[model samples]
Target: MSGKNVPFQDLFVTMTKVAKDAVPIGGLVLIPPKNEHQLLFVLGGTAKVQVDHKHSQPILAADTHFIIKPGQSLQITNQGSHLLDISIIACEVVQLSRADHKLSAASVKTFAYFQYETVSHTPRSLRAMVQKLQEPSTFIDMQKLLENQFLFQKLIYLLMDSHASQTDADPRHAVESTIEYLKLHYDEAITIEDLAGIAQLSRRWYTTLFKEITGENPSDYLIRLRIDKAKELLTMSKESLYAIARKVGFEDEHYFSRRFKQKVGVSPRFYLHNRRILGTTVTHPELMYLLGTIPIAAFSPDQEFPSYLLEAFKQVPKLNNSHHFDPEYFKPFKPDVILAAEWKDYENYDALSRIAPTFLLPSHNDWRDELTDVGEILDKKKQAHRFIRWYDDKRDEVREQLKLLTNNETVAYARMTQEGLIVFGNQSSRGKILYTELGLIPPEKSLLHIDGKILSVEQLAGLGADHIILQIGEQADSSREALLQQPGWRKLMTSPTSRIYTVGHREWYNFSFSPLSTGFAMQHMLQMFERGVVR
Candidate 1:
């Protein structure tokens, strides 16, 4: 700004809201679109702010402010139950001249090419000045000061000074840099001590911080990342499984296949078969999809399908009557076997057996067992094995991708209900995929428990996980929302690595128990993990 005065003018504050009601849990509040630049500050309450798909962050700390550039839409959602208070200061850039050229008066246009930044912590001098000006005793003085050009000049200079003093210093900086290194050299043999050396921290301290931030240990993270890369090559390219395995950091292809089977429940070779033929109506549509077969008819309690099952069920007829399965509905789509899960009523099993060779599928923690049984029943045991292999390949791919994104961070899955939060175990559901299948580390506290246990807010908060996957049920209300506003929940939100991811309750609860649900769940979970944080 080469004018006779400073580059900015202190326009009056445009809007102020105090103790504004919070948006309900899983609800969003949109900031009215504006064509003018505005300085928005999060005066109180923590929220998640998303400006389009590329810009999103948690507003947990106070005084978190960001510039709303012209033509930008801001979406602020209350991640907590407490009311969110905010204020907007509308400002203008003064008309200036530099070297015979007229400077744009529009603040956005003026800084169009320059990178705009935020001042999280006000400088000491500026803070003191603002405090003094805001004092009740200085009411008249403040009014007079606002009317003077000197006030605008001082503010402009202070902002510039603050920007100049900003430094790239943050706690996560080391971890982020080390992850970048890992991504670039994922194909190489890397070790925990080596990564710790990259961070320039002692091995124990580095490992601790890595797990605290990423949810897994360094060795597991590295191995998973390599396997993920190998999976991409196996699926998207024409490379042989052996070559692919070696390319992704495995020394022996046989060893790679063993590890892949243990983690993914299938061999790489068996996973490549793309199609399967099913001659009959199957009760487990999700399982059919997992086994690489499209069912003639699918049974669900209702028409509302989980995201994982949505695409597969689009054209398939639903053998459902409202929220229950009717044995009569199976008569229309008569053909082969009906795979009835043990979780459902078996009285109709005999009736279903009459319609077709209905096999009562045993419900189990390990989804592979269900898959194997379904294969055996359908006389596609070979195809089922191939599906498992395919699933394992996909699992490896997802694990690798997550290893890069999550590093050593751990993830915890919990469900919010009327009673309390339910901490899912690592052996089933999203927990199994996120922790066991995906190779993500669980918080030490979570390791002590198994799945299907309800936890108090204190337990959920104290789980010590770096990231949380909060499963929201269909019947969830304000009471469930209030649970998030608890002191424990607030503490979890304040951590540097604290991130809460919301997923539909139905999608996660039973998706892991069956092969059908597991396939879709694995695909959906991988996509979520790769996307990193959810807003």
Candidate 2:
């Protein structure tokens, strides 16, 4: 700012309110615009502000704030609620030059790219400053105002530091690096400890860190990456299942098929067969396009498949960063890459091969791995890596939490079983019981393309849940049978891992068995699992 009278020095700062009777100055013009920049700070309640034709989201609660350009359309609304208490601030500064050009008065532009689709680092500094101002104040002198503004600058510095550190020094960053390694070397036989060692962190710490970030552990996340890579080779390239398996870290094609079925929900044979390779392969550059294998987004195994494509798109180069992916608004595009996660979409994975290569991840696989596989197909290894690291991190976090819980003086387990099915007949918010809250998350929030149906058993498996109340409903009976008979179940049950303790013995499966009271039966079963009283 070469000008003598700097606009920043004369900034107006004040509290805004409407009159007692009328709309108590629900709005205010801080410094009646002589073409000055304005920044509105929300102190309390909700408000809607507009800049030119663009309206900001209704500012809710304290700490909400926004910046507007000179002559920008600005308005505030109480939204039929109590008049909001807000702080008004403004300045008319010569804009800073973005390029290497000197900061001449003619070349300067006000830094007003503060509006955000999300809480990003660029504007967070100013937002944090506003939030700090919203806190109860003591003295209000020019020095105090200057101090507050200085803190804003400091926040900007910290945001820059945090961003720089995340891409480089952050412990979670290793997961992403590992994904790139896996994508190129999916055929390599890698161990969890081996991957953790790549990051120079202890396995326990790596698992927790991985899970915290990526939502999947190292081994599981890596499997998805390998499977996806294998899909690309299996269909697009003329590789046998064994060759693909060997390339993607599986020692045997049979094991690969089992893992593929778990994660992709279809065996390799079914996937390749369902999706045809219509186009002939090109030799010079090896231009191969993978087709159809779409994961089904199910409302239920029985209901009609959702016509709605709860879609997302991305061109991410690595993890902890995304170029273009939105879970909110649905914009129609060819989806250069589309993820077909519905049973119907998967029927002809070959059809999509013509579009771009697509892979179907089955629900039987943990949702995180399924997500990672899609990422691998799109060459978004970093995102997958971040996810794997996050999951690994969280598992240890939960394990440590469980250890603390078990060590507590009076630990209790409220188990679930068929005979104890009556226990949860009428209850809300009781601790440590098997339950589902389908209504809590909308369709978009859910990982499964599912509606009301829930696979809490999978969730429990992931969380290392200690007990199951196996409700004695028709669904329960069917589930119990599957649990007892399934090979997957036998491996977990026979080998006593995951601290999974079933309260009742095999004898309680009788349809005629009845509990005197649902609550008491549940309580008794829970105690049995905890104390091994039933055994």
Candidate 3:
């Protein structure tokens, strides 16, 4: 019987079953039903009583009792051919306070002074209660059982006192407790002193014993644990390196990176390339986005991302160059593969490979072929070809869509900087989308040879294009607003059949080379042409 069927109020003995049975030779009663706490008393014959592995050899003698706690099993055997009379008490503590009336689960407190693994000798005072319990009774009154329950509570207190003393005296238990504490509080700022306090040992003594028990020094173990956790975060999320440093208990980002590189053998930026599975870390955000992969972190985001690339990379954290080349910073976001651009003098190449498989693609020129090379490395060759085809088709589609404008008006792409009005070439700053993709002709005087050629404001009017796409770069640093108020600017703005359309300066510059960026520029320019300039 269990506590479920036993009706209880205040403090009382919920369930009791008494029996006297005889077992023949070679008989076994292995692990019978037991309550939260049970008392097994040997009334007459000798029987082997075993609770667990450690409780063996402490035989049950006449007039002696053995206690069993929950989760522990009891095995009784009659080794000799003799009848064994045994008294078993199934006792459970129940809710006693009136305050517990509305509680969903009753509070059951245990008072025991011994570990379940060890055997305890019955005290002298408990003998009287054992004698009263041994009497043969098939039926018991509920009200009278409450009066006797007082003795059970008293028995629990005495056992608890004994257990506390034994547990405190054992040095092994203290070490185990300290290990458990470290596992739970590893993420918090913890010191050797705190661990020593948990173990109740002097700093030097605790350090020696911790190494003895765990085989590694306490500080080394803690660092390894933190790095392991950092590795997990690096693989799973797109959190910034700084945020990750703070999370794993490294307040100084640089020191965390140094420690990570020391243990992991690569700087955080390069280490990002390799993850557990097919995870990605790319230096080229624009190209990776076009290739259908969200990079865990990007190196050159150019201060901000374009509107089109924002949705894909909005959650992707930026990896700044300020921390130098420490690969340990990327340990938390354990990337499986790192995609990087070919460098002029790449120093972290070896370091990156140590962290994860790092692939360096061509940085400049022949970008279309470079896209395919990156695809082969990333195992997304099919998607790469499909994207190329889709981009070609979109270029043709936009070319046809802009037929009216292309036939009549030439487009001019220029940026207003602090130096002067800078014009762009077909190789950079959305020039390919305007001239090559959409088939928009450039004006004869539009500085087509120079990538970022600066010219006077008066010289801008010489460009024969019917429309001007002006990119305002670094608005805070530029005098474009004051220039626009000049008479020369007014004349340019009021030119017949010509319109001035403004766009983000740095954003347009960064979107020059990637397929995704080209697509965004194409669609935006087409919309502007079809709807006319708002201002």
Highest lDDT scorer: 3
In each prediction, how many residue pairs overlap at the backbone (N, C-alpha, C within less than 3 A)?
Answer: 12, 59, 28
Candidate 1 lDDT, tens digit per residue, 1-535? 5332333332122222112233555567776656666555555566677764334464633455566765556787777666665544445533334442322222222242123533355444554343333323333675654543344346445654454344324435455556655664577666677666545578898888888877888887777777666655654456777789878878788999998776655777664443222222233666666656677666553346666677766886665433465566667775444566666745566566556555676667677777787666544678888878887887798778778877788777777777667777765465666677778778775463576678877777677777787877546677577976788767766666667777765565465666555555666666776776774
At residue 410, candidate 2 shows an lDDT of: 22
Best by TM-score: 3
RMSD of 1: 26.1
Of the pair 1 and 3, which is ahead by TM-score? 3
Model 3 C-alpha lDDT per residue in residues 1-535, reported as the tens digit of each score: 3442232334343434434455565576665545466667665566787755333546665555676766567788865556665666776655455542221111111211222434455565666666665554434675556545555555555544444465657665555556655564466776788666655678888888788888988888888777766665565456888888888878888998999998888877666564332222222566666776677776543576656666776887766634355655556666666665556314555556556556656566545676787677655678889988888998898898887755657778887877778777676545665676677778773355556667666777777568888877764344877887789888888888668888774456555566765667678778888888645
The stretch of ten residues in a row with the least summed lDDT in candidate 2 is 280-289
Q: Which ranges of candidate 1 are over 4 A from the true structure?
A: 1-283, 301-303, 308-311, 319-329, 332-336, 427-430, 445-448, 477-479, 482-491, 506-510, 514-532
Who is ahead in TM-score, 2 or 3? Answer: 3
Task: Tell how far residue 136 is off in model 1, in angstroms.
Answer: 99
Model 2 TM-score is 0.25
- lDDT-wise, the better of 1 and 3 is 3
* TM per candidate: 0.42, 0.25, 0.45
Q: Residue 18 error for model 1, in Å?
A: 85
By lDDT, is 2 or 3 better? 3
Local distance difference test, candidate 3: 0.63
